[model samples]
Target: MSDQIKVKLPDGSVKEVSKGTTALDIAKGISPRLADAALAAKVAPLPHNGDQPEARLVDLTRPLEEDSELKLLTDRDPEALEVYRHSSAHLLAAAVLDLFPETKLGHGPSTENGFFYDFYRQTPFTPEDLEKIEKRMQELVKEDVPYAREFLPREESLERFKTEGDFMKCHFIEQFTKPDEKISIYKTGKFLDFCRGPHIPSTGKIKAFKLLNIAGAYWLGDEKNPQLQRIYGTSFFSKKDMDEYFAKLEEAKKRDHRVLGKQLDLFSIQELAGPGLIFWHPKGGIIRKEMEDWMREEYLKRGYSLVVTPHVARTDLWKISGHTGYYKQNFFTPMELDDAEYMLKPMNCPGHVLIYRDQLRSYRDLPMRLGEMGTVYRYERSGVMHGLLRVRGFTQDDAHIFCTPSQIEDEISGCIDFAISVLHTYGFNEFKVELSEWDPNDRKSFIGTDEQWNLAQGSLKKVLDARGIPYKSMPGEAAFYGPKIDVKLVDAIGRLWQLSTVQFDFTLPQRFELEYVGEDGKRHQPLMVHRALYGSIERFFGVLIEHYAGAFPVWLSPVQTVLVPIGEKHLEYANKVGDVLKAKGIRVEVDGRNEKMNAKIREHALQKVPFILVVGDKEAEATSVNVRTRGKDKTETVPLDSFVERIEKLIAEKKPTLD
Candidate 1:
């Protein structure tokens, strides 16, 4: 055995360190300050996977067993936060065992929002119990117990968990590990858990934590197994950080789309109508019409042929498209019609395929783009629905491009450019693009031949690279058919929402045997590109609402402008001003109600109208009006003619805001 292994640092310096040397020792060798601030280390193998490292976090005291690239994490590193929070979850489990030793353990993971630990016990935890658990966690932190890692054979681990009545742990051990393999486990005080860990050094490393709430979750996320009690909690590096996190959460709750939807009287999902369905009210409908109009104009400008598809199709059509075999879970149960079983269309791809096959086309007719605001239905699991984000039925801004293999790259580039334009027009300044590729090792999870996957993925990558767009390449994230690119926009609150998707499909064309006449006088298979910029109008609208906190821009507001008359006599002048604005293609509504000017201004402000024009004796005599803008404390008086021109320009530009 070699006495030392070569360790590479970020500065391109290599040093020979003795085998089993801890990361903390390496940090100390680098600098005292580095050692003091170090929290964890990320290690990567020599060759790495792709351009980035296949890295995993490990304790600062954990030993490196092989030649590798190593990165020491400090307090300022974002990854340190994940390790800190995960250790907090371990602290929670340790504390729970101290208080209730009989509680059987399940898995605990660090979620995006926080951390949660599941426990299987006869009695459900209550509010007071959560508080007690939190207190005990604090005590454990003060005691400063070390988190020790140990390994056991998979069979031995399963038997241990089973003997302790930890059925969930036993199931996980059997599911994720082979019978003869060694499984890793972490022990903190009396509590032990099977985990793939990158935990912090000790319990004392977690400074601030709180148990938030309790909820029931099925074991292994399957209802067939007994339900387990999940204890949710959050932790931060410091008390100030924790407080800020809680404050941001409170602010987010205030701007929640569900609450704002009810307050603004925009949309609803009626209990009687059904779950996962949307009913756009008059206010919301107005906004929808505006959105549809913009999309239609863009379609014409971009040379897309708008087409409509039926709401339902025969089972035979789905069978022909292979949707019956592959996408059956998301489809609605079949309905027995007069002669055959029909189903509400779950995807627009099959319908568009039928349209393509309805006619024969020459090579000159290639690269044809078909666009629609098509509505489709899907069966979402009952617990997974979240307002408009996840729904049973929704309208998609869908389009499919049929083109020869030679034209695939340009078509994909066009879709990406179009997606970027959509984000910019909607005031989104930041976005992330992901290139999802199939995993060749996981053959059963993906379809199509290796050649087809290689070609499609290469095209997608080339398009992104040619455009100078940086994207994260995610293996095993591709759709069943082929590779895809998904675009996520970062909103004002720094939250990401998936909006646009451009997918390259290999199965649909082969299933339907779609073809176009080639210049060589032979029929050739045409490639299919499925893209949706606004995934769904409902979902996009919901995100926009939260993005702006219900204060929509001038072009998207349901009521663009409201005219408030100061007195009953001035109502005539207000109507005249509104008429002139409306003549210029602006959406203006006159507030002719018999109320005080202040009251009218406040009401319109609450409705988030972009501009409020108040006409009184002073403004009426001068042929002008007082403008009260939303979110502005003071009002400005401007000429009626000037206001019309300003609003006209805003509408013409489709500007997101008046400013």
Candidate 2:
């Protein structure tokens, strides 16, 4: 072994340093400012074979043991923020332990937006407890408590946690560590935790942090186990960033779909009916009708045959589709009927597959596109279900395309185009695409021959490349049956929602023995592409609710216009105008109640009606109406025909704004 190791910097510079020199030493050697600003380090070992391994985060104080490519992460690095937040979680746990020594610790980890630490105690943590913990965390930050790391024999570590009655920690230690291996531990102040950490140096590095709230979580997500209090919090490198995050959080609260769903009279989850099952009210149903009608029309224009299938099928069908073996956990419990087991369909793919295999297909019918707005049922845990985002029963705008090998690329490109059109029509102008490929070595997780995976993945890549679309290649995110392309859209609030997918499935066709007669007069398996544009209608509706903040586009609004008569004398004219709109296929409502005109206008404005038409003596006589457009203060009197024409154009063009 050499007495010195080589450290390569990201700028392609290498320096020879003594073996076991820490990253902090290298940072200081580069510049004092760099060293002072550094929060953590990333190191990738340069093996003798000259292949560089994936870089992993590490503490600045940790010694570099091999020739490695090193990058010091500071506040500028997004990766460093995750490490900072994780360290903040440790600080939170330490504060909890300081105030309540009897509380047993569970795992603490960083989430996409923040971090959370779980604790088990006889009493649940209160809001006041969170405030005290925050104060204690601030004190610890001032003290500059180091996040000290150490390792001990697995048996000794387990025994220590067992002695302290930390059953959760003991369970984690046993589950994650081998019997003879050493276990990694971190200590922040007086709190010790079983963790494999690459944390920021100390508590002082967490500049701006806040304890958000506490939520109940069953240990290991099993209802049979004891519940733990999970403390949620967020941390940022600067106070300015933290303030901006809180501001966005407040905006998100106002746009929360659950609250707006009730206020807008859109949709609801009835406690008596179920948790995840959604009931579309009259207003919501109208919007859904518009959505479905648009989709079905597009399907026909795109040369897809609309199809519908049964909601329940024999378990034998699932067995043939490989869902019985691979996806049984997500399946609703099977029911017995006529001495045969039946199960609710968790996906629409198998039904489409059956339809395709029903008749022998020829090469001329190579690309058979079948689309459906099918509802499927799945068993979701109670705690995991959200309003409409995560649900048990939802409708998918699903389609399946069975194409020949020669037509695979064209079919994929068509699907991509269709997906982009869906996004554009839904008022989403920004989107990201990801290509998910299978891990070749993970045979147990992914099915199909290597050739099948390569061909399918290559076709998808070719289509993307031809269209000049950039996509992230995500390994191991592929479905068990095949590789896929996922399209995520950025909402108005800059949040990404997974909206569309184009998946290549080869295993299901083989499992079901689906064959088509090729031009060679021989039977061959057709390539199958599974796609969903909306992903889920219910979830898409939820996203729309938040994205528009309950103010839908003119075309999609349940009631396009509401007429408020100035007085009882004008009630007949209001009805007359509403009748004209209705004849033109416009969804119009006439408020003929004996109420003040301003009060009626206010009520319709609260409902987010696109246009509130006021009919009075002038409007009734001139065949005109005063329009109070949503989101606008001024009222304008326009001829009734002219107003109707403008609204018709807005609805026909699907304008996102009323003006």
Candidate 3:
């Protein structure tokens, strides 16, 4: 065997190096600046060989034992950014250990926007402690301590961790490492951790970072186990980027739905009634009614038959639908009944399936669409639950289209049109579409023949292409039964909300034995298209609240116009104005509270009322009212009839803004 190994650079340059030379050595040979900038190297064997030809990230100092292709990673690469944040987490751990030697380490992984590390300590870490920890981390960064990796016998590693009373580490060792395996350990200064890591060369790479906050997490996520202190933090390649991120975070805080929800008195989740269950207050209920009314009207206009299904079904139904096998982790336990086990519905597709199979279908019924505003329940983990975004129970604007293969393209196109209409009507102008197709290599994760998958995926692609819409192709993101298109709308703050989907299904029809007679007099299985425009009503409401910053349009606002009388003397005139607006089918409220005129206007504005009409003696006598619109600084005095006509026209059009 040749003692020299060939190292292929990403730019097509090759270098001859001694077998034991490391990637860092090659980088140094190229340039000292490159060697300093690189955080890690992604290396794969040369000749482009192996069942998995994917390169794996490793420390730059990792020895190259054979011919390989190497790509050095820096802050410019997203993957290296993840590694940088992970190293920041390691620095956090090292800092914590330096400050408190008694603390035992748990896992620390890089999250989407930041990183969090778990630690087991007797004393709870206070805000002051977090500050001290951050201070000490800076000192470690200045030291530029090397992160040395070492291999130890599994038994020795376990014994070492056990000797230090690191029960968490010992448990991880026993759980992950085999008896004859050599456990990889990473040591940063005096802080040693049992981990297989591709960390940066040193701690100095972690330049811009901060300890955000702390929360309690159950050990291994088990309630019965000890709760560990999970410290959250974020890191960036530069100070400017970190500053920009925090600025966006501050803006997000201002638009937070939970805060606005209470301020606007729109919705609430009561504790006694349990979590993830929303009780829409009067104001919120009004908006929800408009939402439901619009949806139902569209259902009729689009030729879809409205249907209602039971909230619970027999466990056998779920079993036959393949949900019991596919989504077992998300299913709630079955309720024991006198006849059989019953289950809360987790989805509405099966209910529609049963409805379609309720009668004989002829070729004329080639395209049957059934729609429902169905409430469903799923078993969500406690820690994973967020406001309305993730909840145990939700109402879905779900519909199912049963059609023949010949009519699939038109049906899919119609669904896309409906979805886009919903977005545009709701004032969402920006959105991203994704086509999720099955992964052929991972056959077990999917449930369909190759022919069925190809046909379904081809139909979705062709429709999108024919419409000239650009979409991201996401492999391995399809539902087990078939492929799908997911539409995510970008809100005002630029956060993407997953709100619509059109999914194809071949397995469900076969499982339910659904059939329709064709023109050729042959019974054939029908194709199923599951479409949900709003995803979940509660979640969509939350998005709406944040999207418009609680300032709804004239049609959707709970109190379209609040008549604020300047004093008790004008109360009669205010009442008259409210009556006139009420007669015209407008939602009007009279603010006759014993408060100052400015206070009344401010209060109504706080509630995000569309119009705050102040009627005084002069205005009342002139048959006009002073109007203060939401999100406007200047007030306009207009004839009561003129204002009514204007708002009525706005409401009729469902305009997104006053102007």
Candidate 4:
């Protein structure tokens, strides 16, 4: 029998260690500096399968029970941040218990943005109480309490939680742990809580942290359950990074689409008109028209047929499409007619499927692309709505391609190219692509066969590699039907927004029973490719407003040029100049009000008009006007005819600048 286990390092080296030796001993043997800096350890069992097992972080003191691959974690690693935040959450709980001895603890974990701890108390936590809690947390940090880990039988843990009157923790212990299992618990000073953790060495390691805010969150996120206080906060490795994070957050707030939308007078959501529905004013409508025009032109240029579909479909249709049963939560209440139940369309896919099956198609007409600006309605939770980004009703610039198996690769490639064109045309210079693939280990979560999944994933990877585009592969992120590619655009402040997706489907085609006759005299199922470049028009427009800060390009601006009269007498000349510009198909507005030239200029500039044409005695006599372009104070005087010609060329070329 072997007394030692062979541990493989990531550097292709192996070390024989005693079977019960812990990861901390291995680190110290390697280097004392590493031992001091190590926060956690990751291990992979030997003889790994194609399924990449999720890496788990464990305490450095955890002992190795078998042969495995070891990876020591440090502060620079992203995974270590989770451990740090979890430790911070513990500090928060300890502080809360010290300040309010009657408070009971709920689960606290690390979020993508930060960490939040939930607490159940008879009375709500006031703002002043939060300040005191924060101060108490700082004191605990100064104390440098050690996080002591221990385990107890499941029954004992439940009994302890029950004795302490922690109903939530008792419920969790009963649900998650088996009777015979040992439950892990961590103790810090007077606080004791159940958890599965790999915390930092001590509380002092948490150097930079701040409590953000407190909100009433339902226990377990269920409205029916008693409410609990959720305190959100963020932590970083250093104070400088935390400061920079706050600075960037402030910059992002300045570019918020909701604020910009109001200031720009672009659109609104009227209370009488109902929530989640948009009312685009004249200025917003002009931009929408331009966007739609460009999209339709591209559809025709790319050999896609423009089709219109109904706004509602029969409930039977949704059942056949498999959405009625699985996606009932997102659908609105159905309307029952005399004969059947009609549902508002939550997606445009089923409509396109009906169109494809309208006629018997042959292999020659296999790759049929149907495009539409389909509007859809969905039921979104009230608290989740955030302006246009998370509205309940929006127009989708959607398309579906029905093609043969042999043509799937080309169709996918074409979709990717089209998405790139969308980014380029919309002035988005940076983007990231993510390929979501099925998890083979979790086969029941998916609907397709292993062969079909393999083929579709290979095709997606091949297309991305052919274009030399880098993408992240996210296992288990795919829909139940098939794999997908989500494209996120990098905004002005470097935050990413998911705006485009190209997905493959095997279940829908099968469910719809769609078929096309092949050249071999056999009927075969057609593959389906669903792609939405702008996901939704309202959301895309919101992103655009934030991207450009309401100053649209020449082709998209509602009032491309404004004619300002320096004095009331110059109104005639301004009208003449406006007429000349309008003749060239440029959108121009004349400002003939009796206001100062500087005031008029300032007002137009504030409106973000691309160009301001000032006509005064100097230019009215000579039949010239002074042009004040946006973002610049200098004025260039030119003849009225010459100025009209310049704007005509600029608008015709669809220039993004006024110059």
TM-score of each candidate? 0.96, 0.94, 0.86, 0.93
Minimum summed lDDT over a 10-residue window in model 1 is located at 45-54
Query: Residue 8: error of model 3 in Å?
Result: 8.9
Model 4 ranges off by over 4 Å? 1-34, 46-53, 440-445, 620-625, 638-659
lDDT of each: 0.88, 0.93, 0.92, 0.88
Q: Encode model 2's per-residue lDDT on 1-659: one tens digit a residue.
A: 68899999999999999988999999999999999899999998976676657778999999998889999999999999989999999999999999999999988999999999999999988899989999999999999999999999999999999999999999998888899898999999999999888888888888999999999989998989999999999999999999999898898899999999999999999999988999999999999999999999999999999999999999999998888788888899999998899999899999999999999999998799999999999999887899999999999999999989888999999999999999999899999999999999899998888998999899999999999999998989999999999999999888899989999999888988999999989999998999999999999999999999999999999999999998898999999999999999999999998887788888889889999998889999899999988999898999988998999999899888887
Which candidate leads the pack in lDDT?
A: 2
lDDT of 1 by residue, 350-447 (tens): 88888898988889998889999999999999789988788999999999999999999999998998899889888898999999999999887888
Please provide, for model 4 over 1-659, each residue's C-alpha lDDT reduced to its tens digit, 9 standing for 90 to 100.
88789888889899999998888899999999999888788887766556555566888888888887889888889988989888888899999999999999998899876799999998988889889988998898899887878999998999989998999999888888888999999888899988878887778778899889998989888889999999888888889979988998997787787887888888998888777888898889999999999999999999999999999989888898888766899999999999899999999999999999988889999799999999999999878878889888999999999999999999999999999999878878899999999998996678889998988899899999999999999989998888999999997777788999999988888999999999998999999999999989999999988888788888889999999987788898889988888888888999887778889888889899998988889998899989888888688998888877787777766776677
Candidate 4 collision pairs: none
Model 3 root-mean-square deviation: 3.9
The total number of steric clashes, by the backbone 3 Å criterion, in model 4 comes to: 0
Off by over 4 Å in 3: 1-37, 40-73, 148-184, 326-338, 381-384, 433-446, 454-478, 617-622
Please give the range of 10 consecutive residues that has the lowest summed lDDT in model 2. 46-55
Cα deviation in Å at residue 5, candidate 3? 9.7
Give residue 61's lDDT in candidate 4 (0 to 100).
80
Model 3 lDDT per residue over 350-431, tens place: 8999999999898798799999999999998877887878889999999999999999999999999999999999999999
What TM-score would candidate 4 get against the native?
Answer: 0.93
Models ranked on lDDT: 2, 3, 4, 1
Q: Give lDDT: candidate 1, residue 41.
A: 92
| Candidate 1, superposed: residue stretches over 4 Å from native | 48-53
